[model samples]
Target: MKPKIELLAPGGDVQAIKAAIIAGADAVYCGLDTFNARNRAANISFDQLVGIIRLAHQYDCQIFLTLNIVILEQEFKTLFNLLNKLVNTTLDGVIVQDMGLLYVLHHYFPTLDIHASTQLTTHNAGQIPFLKKLGVSRVNLSRELNLREITALAKVGQEHDTLLEVFVHGSLCVAFSGLCYSTSASAGNSGNRGRCSQACREEYETTESGHNFPLNIKDNSAFFDLPALIEAGVYSFKVEGRIKGASYVHTVIDSFRKQIDGYVATGELTQDGERLYKVFNRDFTNAFLRGDLNQSMFIDNPRDNSNNHLVDKLKAEKGESISVVQIHSAQQQLQVDKQQITSSVDEKIAHLSIEKIKLSLSFASELDGPLRLTVVTEQSDSLLPGQAVKTDSQVFTSSSVMIPSEELSVDRQAIEKRFKSINNANYELVELDTQQLTDGLSIPFREITTLKNELLSYLNAGVAMIAHVQPPKLEHHPKADGPLGLSMLICDEADVALADMTDGDIYFKLPDAYKRGCTKYVDFLLQNPRLIPWFPPVLIGKDFEVALNILQQVKPKLIVTNNTGIAYHAEQLGIQWIAGPFLNTTNSYALLALKQGAACSGAFISNEINRQQIKQIARPKDFKLLYSIYHPILLMASRQCFFQQSVGCEKPRIDNGCMLSCDKSTSIKNLKGDSFAIDKQKAGYPSIYNQDQFLNTDIINDLSDKFDGFMIDLTNIGAGDRVSPDKVELITQFQALLDGQSEASAKLSRLVPESTLLQYQNGL
Candidate 1:
C-alpha cells in the first residue's frame, strides 16, 4: 500500500492542540508567543510547547513550531535563545519565512529541519530547488495555485527530495499570501509580521458593480478533492485556522480525519461535508483547486456563514426563500449542533493535560564511590508518595566521586539548587528524594555540573547537550563615504527618454507574465544596455522560465530581482543581482545573508520601516543600499481578477489572455472614504494600490550618508485618471536632491504634491 498522506492541523493553544491530537491529526503546527506569523492566535509558551511535544510524541503525532515571520535585527538574540532551547527537544520541524533566519538555522541549528513558510510566495518549479538549496525539507506552496500547478510542483519536490504541503481547508485571501501590503501602507499592521488588519475583509463602499466587500473571497475547501490531491503525490494535507478556537479545530479536523481515513482504507469517502458548515466559515469554494477562476469564488459577507448557510440549505431544499420564523429555527438548530461539538471536544480533551511531567530525583552516595542518581517521572495527576511510577526509572552514575565533608555537605537544598535545571520546560523537579544517601557528603562544583549535564543528556534521550550559540561577530565593514546616486524606474517606452536627461541608471520594469518563448524582452534589454532589468516579486510556471531566458540571453552585468528563485539563478550564472525592495529586506543580517548566500550585490531597504529602523541597519562592505523616494504605494497583487467585483469585467473568468492583454482600471472606497486604485496594466496581474503615491524627502535629509542610491519611480501604474507628473522634471529634482541641493526638495514636493509618506513614520 502507498504511504498515507499526513493530516496537518493547526494548534493555536494548549487546549486546541490537545483537541487536534485527540481528533486524529497526524501532525500539528503551532506558534509561540513571539516570532510567528499569527500574532492574533493564542500562541503557546515555551513550557507548554515542551510539554506538548512530549504528549504529541506519545501518540505518534509530530509537532511543528511556527517561527515564520521576518526577523528584525534586534530580535535575533531572543530568536537564538529560543532556538537553543528548541534544539534540545525532539521537535519535528520549524516553519520559516526570513532568508536570514534560514541562514542562521541551517548553519547553527543543523539538526532542526526547516520547512518553508507560505510567506516565501513559493509558486514556480525553480523555487523548489531554491528552497532546497537553503535546507528546506518541506514547502507549503502558494495557496493561489491550481491543481495542475500544484501537481507539477509536487513532482519537482519529489525530484528535489522535499515534501509538499498544501492547505486543504482554510480562510482564503484574495491577494497572494506573502505579497499583500494592504494594511501595512496605512494601518501599520504588516501581514508579513503576522499582524494583518484584514483589510481584504473590511467593508467598502458599494462599487460600480455593487460590492461592499470587494476583496473578500469565500473560504477554501478541498474535502472531496482529497483523492485527487493524494494522487498528485502530496505528502501533507494542511488545515489553516491557528486563530480559530478548539471547537472549530476539532470539528474540522475530525471531519477531515474521517474523510481521509475512509477514502484511504476503502477507496470511497464515508463522511458527508455538511458538518463543516456548522462551524465558522465564509461558505466554501473549490474553484482554485479545480483551476476555475470565476465570480462564484467570492462571497457577499466575510463573517460566519454557518447560520445563513443552514437557512439557505433549508430554503434550497424547499426551492424558495424561507420566512424569518423558519430562518430562526434553522439558525437555532445550527447553534445547538455547534454547542454539542464544543462540549464533545471539551470532554474528550479534559484528560489530556500539557502540564510539565513531574520528576523525583533521588541521590545516593556512600564514602568515595561515584555518586548515583535515580530519576522517576510522576503521572500528570500528581502521584502521592509511594504511588506507582507511570514511567520507567533511569539511573545515572556521576563521573566524579563524593567525599565526606562537614563544611560543604550534600543536602536536599544543595541538590535541588545544583540540579535546578532539572525543573525545566519538559520536567518539573517536584521532589528531591535524597534520603537514600547519608548526609555530610560533598563533590567538586564542576563535577556537580558534569553530573547535571549527564542527567540532562539522559532526559533528552541520550542526545549530547548542544551549547548555546553566540553568533560570530560580523566584521564591521562600513563603506567609504560617497554621494548617493539617482536611479529611476521606467515601465513605458516614453520614460526611456528620461535616461538621457540624467547620468543616473535606468531600470526597465519586467512583467510578471510573459508570452511563451517570448524573445521581445530579451531583444528589448539587448537594445537598451543603459536600462537594467527589474524583475517583479511574483513569477510562476513558464513566466519564470521566460525571466530566466531573458537573463541567459542578455546576460546583463547586473540586475535587480524581487524573486529569490531568480536571484538564485542569477548567482549560478555568475551574474550579479540586486535584491529588490519587494523581497522585504529589513535588517543587516538579511543583507549579509543575501550577499553571502546568493552573492547579491546590493539590496533596497524595505519601505515599510521608519527612519530609526532604516538607520539601525549596518551596511556590508561593497553592498549597495537603495531606497525608493517616490512611487505608487502598492497594496497587493493577486492572481484573481480585482475587476470582477470592483468595476465588473465582461469576461466571466480570468485567463492568460486577461493577464497578457487586458488593461483596465477602477477604484474602491472604504467606509473611511479612503480610495484605493485597482489597476491592471497590459501583460500584468491585477493589483491594488493606494490612491496617493509615496514621496518621502525626509529620508534623504536624515540618512543620505547611509545609502548608495536613491530611486524614483517614473511608472504610471496606479495613477488611474489622475494627471501624470512630469517625468523629466521629476528626474532632475531627484538627482539634485541626491546632490544635496536644498531647494530640490521643495521643488520635488510641489511636483509630487499628491503623495504620502505614512510608512516612513510607522515602522514594522
Candidate 2:
C-alpha cells in the first residue's frame, strides 16, 4: 500500500499545537523561541517544547522543529548548544534553510532527519541530488513549481529516497523565497533573518496611473489538487501560517485533513471552501501549480470576504455544545470564551481530553490445553485507525498466566465484557484476536484492566528511553583558505565607462530583463577580460532556459549567479560560476558545500552580515570573497510590470513589443516619502532600488585583510541627474578611496549628503 500523504500544520505556539493535533494533523511544524523563520510568532519556550512533543506523540502525531532561518558564523556556538539540547529530546526532525546549519545538524545528529526549508528555493530536480548529498532527507520545494516540475522532482526524490514536500496552502511571496532582498535593502529588516517589513504589500503609483498594491500576490489554495499532488508523489502536504492564531491553524488543518482523508478513502475531495476562506486568506490562486502565469493572482485589495452566515452558524453550533462545559469551571469558562473567537467547542473539547494510548490483544489455546492471553503496545499509526495490531517483535509484549481450568467453563460473553470494560476513553483497542477460545473463557474485569494499565506504563517509559538515544559525534574542522580579489558590479553603460577608473576586477550585471540596448556593450565586454557577466537572481520557469541560452552565447570568462537553477545549469554547460549573495552563504560549511559543485569558484558573504559577524566566517583561506562597498541596494525584483499593472499600459515591456516607457526615470514614493527608483529596462522583470547609495568607506580598511576584494555595485545610480553627475562624482570618490587618496572621504561627503551603511555595523 502507498504511504498515506502527511498533512503538516503550523504550530505557532503551545495553543496552536493543541489545536492542530486536535484538528487531525499528522505532523506539526513549529519554531522554538529563537533561530526560526517566523521569529515574530509567539514560539514555544524551551520549557514548553518537551511537553508539546510528548503531547503530540501521544496523539500519534509528529513534531518538526523549525530552525529554518539563516544562521551567522557568530551564532554557531548557540546553535550547536541548541542542537545538543534537542538531541536529548523527542524532536522528529528539523526544517533548515541554511546549508551550513544542515551540515552541522547532519554531522552532529546523524540519526535525526533534516528537511530543506522552502527558503532554499529548491524548484528543480537537478538541485535535489546535491541536497540529498548534504544528507537532507526531505526537500520542501519552492512554491513556484508547476505540476510537471513537481512530478519531475518527485521522480528524482523517489530514486534517491529523499521525500518531496510541497506547500499546498499559504500566502504567496511575490519574489521567490530566499531570493527577495527588498525588505532587507529598503528597511534593514531581512526576510532571511525572520524580520520582513513586507514592503511588497505597500501601495505604489505608476507614471500613467494612480496608486495600487501591485506586488501583493494572492494566497495559494490547492484544495482541488490534492489527488494530483499525491499522484505526483508528494510525500507531505504543508500548510503555511506560523504567525497565525490557533483557530486559524485548526480550521485550515481540519479542512485539509478532511479533504486528504476523503480523497484517500473514496478518490474524491471533500472541500470546506467557505471554512478555509473564513480561516484567513487575502485571495486564492492555484496559478503556480497550474503553470498559469497569465492568471490574475494579485489581491489588489486584500480583504477578508468570508461568508458571515457560515461563521455565525459555526459559532452558534459551538456555543450550544460548550455551554455545559462552561458551567463546570469558571476558569475553563473564561478560557473557552477567549478561545471561541479562534476555535469551535469541539476543538476545545478535544484539547481538554488527553490523547488515548493504543493497545492490541490476542487469546490463543489448544483444544485440550490452557488458554493464553497476550497484550502488545507500540506507537500508533493514526492513518490506519482500526489496524493497530503489531507482531510480537514489533511491540513490547507481556503474556498473562494461562487461564485457570475452572475459567474454561466461564461465560464467553463475560470475557468479552471484561475486555471492553477498559474505560476513561484513554485506550483505543486496535485489534482483538480470539482464535481457540470459541467454547468459553472467563477473566476477571480487574485483571484485564490491570494488564492494560501495565502496558500503558511500559509504553510511556519506552517513549522516554527512545528520546534519550544520542547519535555518534563527528569531527569538526576549523577555518580554511578562500579566494581573495576585488570585484565591481556595473549595471549601465555609464557605469561601464567608469569601470576602468577604479583599480578593481569588474563584473557586468546582465539586466534581469534582456534589453536591446545591452547589445552595444558586447564589443566593449569582449575586449576586457577582467569584466565577467553576472546573471540575474530571479530566473525561473520559462525565463530560466532563456537566460541559460543567453549566457551560453555570451561565453564570458566566468558567470556569477544567485539562483541555484542557474548554478546547476552552469555546471551542465561547463561554465565556471561563483555563488552570489542571494545564496545566503553565512558560514564556512555552506561555502565548502557550494565549492564542491563543479561550476562553483567561490561565494560572496551574505550582505546581511555585519562586520563582526563576517569576520567570524571560517571559509577556506583562498576562497574569493566579494564584499559590496558601494551600490544602490535592490529593494525588489518583480515579474509583474509596475507600469502595466498600475499605469494601465496595454502591453508590459516584458512582452518585447511594448514601447520602452520605463527607459525614462520612474520612482515610487512610500508612506515615509522615501522614493525608490524603478528600472524596467531589464529582460524578464524590473527591479526597485533604494533611493540612497550604500557606502561603507569607513569599514573598508578593516574588511580589506579579511576579504580578497570589495564589490562596487553601480546599479540604478544617479536617477534624477540629466548628465549623470551623481554617478560620475560617486565613482570618482570611490576610485580615490580605493587608491588610498587622503581626501576621498571629504570628496564623497560633498557629493552625497546621506548614505546608508546597511547591515555593515549592525547585523539583523
Candidate 3:
C-alpha cells in the first residue's frame, strides 16, 4: 500500500512561514537564528518559532525545525540548552544531521521526534535500519536516487517503521549533499554547516565546450511524476529553498498543493505546472528522477529562468524572432505575475499571527487561607493596543497560608518576584493583581517556590518541568602504545612494493560505480593479499550488490569504506571495517555511535577540523583514531558528467559505459584566477578538486598523541595539470615525517610545492 503523501514546504522567514501555512502546505521545515544549517536565511527567533508553531497547528500543518549542521565539541552545551527549550514547546519534530544530537535526544528528550537530515546522504537500503536503530522516525532520502531505488528503500523503511522523504521540487545540488567541500576548502564556509557559497553556480572561464557555467544544472521538479512517487510508497515530498522569499515559497507551494490534490481526487494532474515558472527557477528537469542522465540537465544560466522562459513563450506565440521591445514586454509581464503572487499571499496570511501571548496573573489571599492564583492568557494583537481577548485560563491553588513571623509576608512584591520568569519566549506575565495578599499571610519559602513551579507547569499545558541535563562525564581512553602503523592509498596494483619498502599499510581505492557481475576486482584482491580493499563513497543498485559480492568472495580480514551501506553490511558479516574519512566524524559522541551502531574498530577523523577540535574528541575504548595528512582536496562529486559542458562529449547522455571508458581531466579557472581540477576516472564519478593538495604536517607535532595512525594519498586521480611526484618518494617522506625526522617535511614540501591547510586552520 502507498503511504500518505505530505506536501512539505520551506520557511526562511516569518512571512514565508505564514505563506506556507496559507498556501495549504501539509508540513513546513524552517530554521531558527542559531544552530540551524541555513545561516544565510532570515531565520526566525525562539519566540517567533513558538508563535509560529501555534499558528501552523491551527491549520492542521506540522512544523519541523532544522538542526541539520555537524556538531562540534565546544558547542554541545549550547545545543543541549536549545534542546531543553525545544522539548517544552509544541514543536512537531526536529530534522537533524549530527549523530551526537541523536544520542542525546534519544536519551534525554524522548518526546522530540527525530527526522534524519539529507546531510546523512541516505540512499541504499542498508542505511534505513542503520538510522532507525538510532531512533530516527523519518529520513530525507538523497536527492540522486531514482524511482526504482526509492521504491526499494521505501520498502525497507516500512519494515522498520521509518518514513522516507524525497526532494520533489527544488534546486538540485551538483554533488552529493554531505560530501561536497567546495567552499570549505577555499574559504572557512562549509556546506555541511549550511554556509555554501554556491560555487557550482559561479561563472567560469569558457571551456573547450564553450560554456561558462559547466557545473550548474537546472532545478529539479517532479510535478508529472507524482503518481510514480506515490506508487513508490514515499511518505513526504519536500521542496528545497529556505533562502527563497515568501512570494517564491507561496507560489511553489500553492501550485504543488493543487496538483497533488487534483491528482489524488480525480486521478489526473489538472495543473500543467506552468505557474511554477512564474517565480524563480532554472527551467526544470526530472532527469534524475527518471534515471536518465543527459546533457540537457546542464543549463548555461544559473540565475532565474522565468523571464527567459516568458520571452521564449512570447516568441513562439508570435512566430517571430525575439525583439528588444518584445523582451521588455516579457520582463514587465513577469513582474506583474510576481506582484500578483505576492499580493495574493499577503492577503491570505493577514489573519495569522505569531505575536507573543499575553498573560494576566491574579493573586488573592486571606487570613489563614490557601494561596489562590488565577492565570489568564490573552492573544496579543498589534491592532488592539490596550485591550486583548482572553484565550486560556487556569486556577492553581496551593497549601494553606500560615501566620507570618520569621519569613516575609506574601505581599504584591513577593508574589511578583516569585513568578516573573514566566515572562519569556512563550508569554508576557506583566498584569499581576495581588491586592488581597497584603493581609500579611505567608507560607514557607520552599513552599512558595514549589507553588510557583506548579503554576509554571500548568501554564505550559500540563508539561512537567524538565531539569537541565548536564554534560555527561566521559573517561578519556588513550590510544595504545606503538603507532597503529602508517598507511597510504593507491589505486594501482604496481604500488604494492612501496608498502614493503616504506613500512606502511597499503589500501586499494575502489571505484564509485561498477559493472554488474564484474569479478575483476574480486580476482585482483584475492591474488594480491597485501592490498586492503578501500570502498568508495557511492554504490547504488547493481553496483552495491557487486561490491557486496566482492566483500563476501574475498573475505578480507579488514577493509576501509566511506559508504555507511558498506559499513552496515560489514558489521553483520563480522568483517573488521574502519569508517573512512568521508563519514564526517566530528564529536566524541559520534565516535560512540559508530562503535555501538556498527562495532566499528577505527575511523579517520575528518580533515575539516583543526588541532584543537581533533584533541577534544574522546576516543571510544579499543577504537583507533586516524587522520589523513596528505591528499588531493576533493570539492565535489556528481552523478552528472561535467565533461558534457566542459570539454564536450559526443554522447547525448551518460550510461554505464561512460563510467568504464570515459577518463577526462580539465581545469576551470574562476574569475579570481583560482583554478580547480575536474577529473573523471574510469568507473568513477566526475569530481572537482583544489589545484593544491592538502598537506598538513603540523598535526604530527601538534597532537600526535591524539591519533593512532596517519595516511597519505598516492593516487593520481586528482592530480589534474600538475604531475605528481614518484609514489615511492611520497611514501618514504611521509613515513619519515611520522618518525619525527625534521627534514622530511621540507623535502616533501619541495616535491609538492602547492598545498593547503585551510580546513585544518578554520576548525569548523
Which scores higher on lDDT, 2 or 3? 3
Predictions in order: lDDT: 0.88, 0.69, 0.87
Residues 1-764, model 1: lDDT tens digits: 85668999999998899889988999999999999899999999999898898878867899999999887777888888999999999999999998889888888999999999999999888778888887799999999888888999999999999999999998988988888899999977999999999989999999889998989999999999999999888999999999999999999999999999999889998998998998899999888888789999988899999877887788788766668888887778778888999998988887776677778888898888878898887655312223334676888887777788999887777787878667888888888888877688888867778888888888887898899898767654665675567888998876677788777678999999999999998988898898899999899888989999999999999999999889988988999999999988888888877887778999999999889988878788888889998999999999899988988988998889999999898889999999999899998989999988999999988987788778888889888778888888888788787777889988988988888899999888
Instruction: Give each model a TM-score.
Output: 0.96, 0.73, 0.96
Best to worst by lDDT, what's the order? 1, 3, 2
What does the lDDT read for residue 298 in candidate 3? 89
lDDT of 3 by residue, 25-112 (tens): 9999999988788999999999999998887887889999999988888888898889989988889999988877888787778899
Clashing pairs in 1: none
From the highest TM-score down, the ranking of the candidates is 1, 3, 2
TM-score, structure 3 vs. true: 0.96
Model 2 residue 189 lDDT score:
78
The TM-score between candidate 1 and the true structure equals 0.96
Query: How well is each residue in 39-103 modelled by candidate 2, as lDDT tens digits?
Result: 88999876577667767776889999999888877677777767766765668999999988777
lDDT value for model 2: 0.69
Q: Give the TM-score of candidate 2.
A: 0.73
